[model samples]
Target: MFSLGNVRVRTKLIGGFIIVSLLIGLVGGLGVISLKNVGKKAEGIYSQNLRVVYILTDMQANLERVRGNMAELIYVKDQAQKDELKKSIANDKEENTNYMSEFESINISDEEKKVYEEFQKNITQYRSLRENVIKLVDEGNFEEAEKQYVPIRKVTEPMFISLDKLININVDSAKSANDNIKAINASSNMIMMALSIIGLILAILLGVILSRDINKPLQKIKMFGEKLANYDLNFDFEVTRKDEFGQTGGSLVIAQNNIKELVKTIIENSQSMSAASEELSATVEEISSKAINIDEAVNTIASNMQEASAETEEIGASIEEVDSSVIVLSQKAMEGSNNSNESKVRAKEVKDSSKKAIEESQIIFNEKKNRMLKAIEDEKVVENIKVMAGTIASIAEQTNLLALNAAIEAARAGEQGKGFAVVAEEVRTLAEQSAEAVKNIQETIEEVQKAFKNSIDTGNDILEFINTDVHKQFTEYEKTGNQYYSDADFVSTMSENIAAMSEEITATVGQVSEAMQNMAQNTQKSSEQAEEIRESVNETTQALEHVALTAQNQAELAQKLNEVIQKFNI
Candidate 1:
């Protein structure tokens, strides 16, 4: 069934207002119609009835004036006075005729028209009689004019009666018009009053309907909201209407049911979680014990690995020392080889120089002896010998300069120039010796002639000794240098072999040391891993304990929630 309760509030209010407004409109419209009708009837009465009455009254007044003028015509004897009255009587009759025309022009009913026609006939008779009376008066027949005028009373009497009747018709019609106006006014007042009452009733009914439709459900929803605020879900609110309030109340019902179910589920889950938390606490303890044992074992292995690493480091250090010693011996052998080779080179160079010196000495001796003998035969031997000594001294000076230049070049050669520098120093010494011998020979030139023969004999013995002893000493120096070079070469080769072996041993020791270090690092990492595992187990145990506490709290909260939920009546 369609119900007003299910109707929208706005629609209800609007329908109620429309009904009241329509009633008001009807009331207003009826009043306007009634007033309009009254105005039309009043206008009809004024135009048709009142105006006719006005014209009839004017006609009656004209009759009276005509009657008075007729009497005046009878009494007056002056011709001028009679003429004046006659003119006045004629004007009065003309005015009455015009009034009759106006009366005929107005709208009237058949009965009013009949009565007006009768009045018109009687007034016509009265006017005819009045004219006869006036004609007699004008003829100076006073007696007869008086007699004629007396009969006018008979005509005017009925004429005035018809006039009064006609007037009364209009009066009666006006009265009826007033009565109709009164009736319309009375009916319109009644209808307006009825409509007013109906509108008021409708207004009140609409107020009641709107207020009840909105406020009843609103108050219910408000109460429901208050209960929900207080966490009371036990209040049963059913949606009885399809209005806005009903829909909102339905939503609240759904929310309360959902919350109730959720609280129940949480209670059950809390119980399960509490049991699981206890089991997990025991498992965490067992894990912590095993983690501690593994940590101790890893620490023991790490300690043994550390000892092995230390021993490997010691062996590496010993091999390093041996390698250092081998390096030093190899360096010494290389130095001996270089020095021997230098000596052998110097010996070879000295031997070649000695042979050149012997040749050059013999050529110089023969040439100087021939010059000396020639200078003696010319008694210029002393001067020539002195010149030769000076020449020799100059050569020695130049040789010393060359030796100094050689020494400078040797000095620039660094360590390799030590042998060359020694050789240059010997050359400088020989140059100085040559210079001294030149000085002595120059001082003993006279004795040189005396020793010339002995000098020939000494030269023979010197050449033989130089050719034999000097050549032999040069050869022996070359041999000894070769031997020293061979020995030094042998020593250098042996020392290199020893150094290579030592380096190989050192590299082996280094590899062992590195392996040991890696093993120790692995052991240390294992120990740290064990420590981390133990710490993680301890942390996990702590976390489990926290979780257990939290679970217990959750269970308690769930129990409290169940108790709270019991307060609701959803």
Candidate 2:
């Protein structure tokens, strides 16, 4: 259920390497453990199983030597030679006793112990019969010594059978040890292979998922960029992943919508220009006919100029009064301009302070984000958690294996092993609990990492909003103040211009009739220019047609690009 979409690419790469390292470590650990088990098996054979067989075999050989020594005693007549033979037989008896003591101390099975008891009973009988034969020989009763020797030799048959059975038990134990070592080695290989395969599959799956996440968004952005280059702004950039590409694609979509609005504004302005050009072409024809009749209106203009000259004298007095009032209005306008300038400065100050605050907030937020990312990248606490989890898992595995070995050994001990089996079971239970705890710890760490990532993302979203939205609002507020100051200055300048124009009108009233006669002459000249204007209008119409064709082509191209972009989910 976990998704790779929101996960950072850097994390994916690091996780991939971590998975590989864990795999190699697990395989290596398994190899080491298998080698350790083999070593223990070899050591067990040498310390117990093989040792038992060697001791019992050596006891059998010593008994054969005792039989030889007993035969030598029956034939020897010299007392000194007889004492030497008796001493050799006593030495062999002492060695057999030592071998029997060593054999009894070993932890053997119940069946092997029964066989050992029978051998001990028969061996005691043989030793007693040999002692009787030796006493007879010492007293020079050769016939009685020979009869006791026959009985001594006969007693060894059952003893030899018991020795063989004891040796067989130890030999079988050695064979089982060898088998156990082989089983451990085989199981280790199989487990290692299985785990390695599973690890590789998981790693590959992660890589593929990461690749898909990256490639899908990248391809969308690439196509979106290509379309943008062609002036296409209608692409559906719907990539909603929380990773880098998603953010970039979302920004592109916003830019696209903004550009589309700008282009639409441009198209509207072009249409307005086309309409104004059409109106100008219609007015040009009316002006061409009106230019010929300018003489008729000149008389009317001359009569109005005389009336204007009479009124100009009265206007001079009114202009004096109006100029004073205009001066006062200009003074007030200047005051308003100054006030606006002060307000603009204050607004700029507020804007700068807000911008600084936003910038500082961004810096602090980025610094914290970087620190957290650095900690995660540098493996600060997460590394310790991973190491601790790995160690716990290793301990649990080793403890479980040890418990199983102990259980096997206890079962081999028969009734004496029941308590040890219970202990091994308890140890195994504790090991399983440790393994489960490690699993829980790992899961909790994963959840913690996800939580940390979400926190970082939320911080990023807040910072982005402040920079892109809040900052723009402050810029607009500053612009409003600037516009207010500009309007106030324009009002002051316009008032001064109107006062100067009033005086210029009083002087020019006398020359108005003379100016109209000159305009009549210029109007006659405009008749000739009107013909040229008509021809120019025709050329302008052709240019407008070309512009309309270009706009149509552009619209078609935009449509095609939109269709292509619409296919992407972004």
Candidate 3:
């Protein structure tokens, strides 16, 4: 039959009782041995009684030998026979005394010791009386020796009877003691045999009972486990005890019942799950298709953004072109202004040169008139020459002042005006030289007036021709006539400055255009990537929904199994 737990109750109780009883029996046997000192005392007394009996018998034998020698002395008439008998009697008496003393020393019953002492007294009296008879015989009183032997026999016969009586009593007591020892040994042997037999029987019985108790419940558990392994869903088991082993058995039974219910629920849920899984898989496929559509939409938006970025790039390029054109126009305008300034400076120089030519022609005419007058030594021509020299000196000082003003302006222009400053310094030096020339001319005119008065007429005619021709030519000139001519060096410096500024502007424009292009491209790319990320998140949400549904199905299956298990009493 099947027990719910791993072991039975009856077998365990039987084995436990048997173990206790065996332990008690072993203690009892030890107690019997512990209190056995009396038996040893009995055995010791028996041994001493045996030794006493032996000594007494040896003493009796010695006494008999002494009596026989006395009889032999009576029959013999020879002196040698009497002497030999006396010597024999002496040796026997010594041996008998030693034996009696030893027998008295032994520990026997008080009554036995009293009987031994009475026997010893009689033997001593008989020996003393026999010795008197022997003395009479040695004195040749044969009749008197025969009379003494009569009394010795009386003593000897009674003593021998008492010795035999003591021997018989000791033998009887020894026999009784030995029988008691044999009986005790037999009883102890019997007790040991009986206890051993009982212990063996109890051990065998306990073994069978304990084996059954353990094996029964274990067999039940094993069978249930086997069924569980086989996935049997209809089996139920129960345990109804309260020990540790019983509790284990009960727990196992519950576990088995739970497993059976669980298996049934799993089987049922598996059928339902198969259909749901198919629907879920189909739904996931639909979701994946929608994600693909969203991806396509994102791709379209990305393409449009790319086109917009490209349009912006083109617009930026156009703006850059306009900026470059403006830069070129500014450079050309600055160059024209620089050219106009140079032309004005060149025209001023030409005007100054023409005025100087007219002044020099007027001076030649005056010199000729003075020469003509000087032929008659005229003082008016000399005074006119001095006035011309003073006017030339004042003109030279004004030119030098103008040159100093130009030098100051050139100095303000730094390294760019080094050539202008050099030209201004040269003009100043020419003005100083012209002043010296005018002074020399005034001195020469004075010397001429004094020494070449007659040659003055010819000089006057040549002067008149030179003055008329120079004046005619100078009158056709205008101060602004050379205004159109520009200074090539100043124009070149302006062009170089313009070219450097244009290069800087061009580089800055190019950088601005490149930065704008990069910004537009990055913004477009970010918008496209954001749309992609949004699509990915939507897909992830759908996947999480599917997973949540799967987990919900598992939890529902577990609940159903719990309900199914409730049907069993186990």
lDDT of 2 by residue, 287-402 (tens): 54464355335445545554555455455555555555655655665566566556656665665666666677668657866775775675458767878898999999999999
Candidate 3 per-residue lDDT, tens place, 298-372, comes to 667767776777787787878678667857755785676576566666666666667787888788788767656
Model 3 regions more than 4 Å off? 1-42, 74-84, 137-140, 185-212, 257-570
Q: Which model, 1 or 3, shows the larger TM-score?
A: 1
Give the range of the ten consecutive residues with the poorest summed lDDT in model 2. Answer: 291-300
Best by TM-score: 1
- In model 2, the clashing pairs are none
Which digits, one per residue and each the tens of the lDDT, describe model 1 over residues 1-570?
Answer: 988768876687788888888988888899889989999998898888878878888877887887887777788888898888888888887888788777777767888778767777877787777777777776778898888777778877877887898888789989988998998899889889988997898789888878877898899989988998887777889789887667788888998899888867765675575567567656656765665676566566656655665666676576666656655665665565566556556655665665566566567656756665554465455668779889999999999999999999999998999899999999999999999999898778767655665655665666566557765675666566556656655655665566566566657666766766676666666656666666665676567667656756765665676676566554
**Candidate 3, position 114, lDDT:** 82
Q: Would you list the C-alpha lDDT of every candidate in the order shown?
A: 0.75, 0.75, 0.73
Those runs of model 1 whose alpha carbons end farther than 4 Å from true positions after fitting are 139-144, 257-570
Roughly what TM-score does model 1 have, to 2 decimal places? 0.45
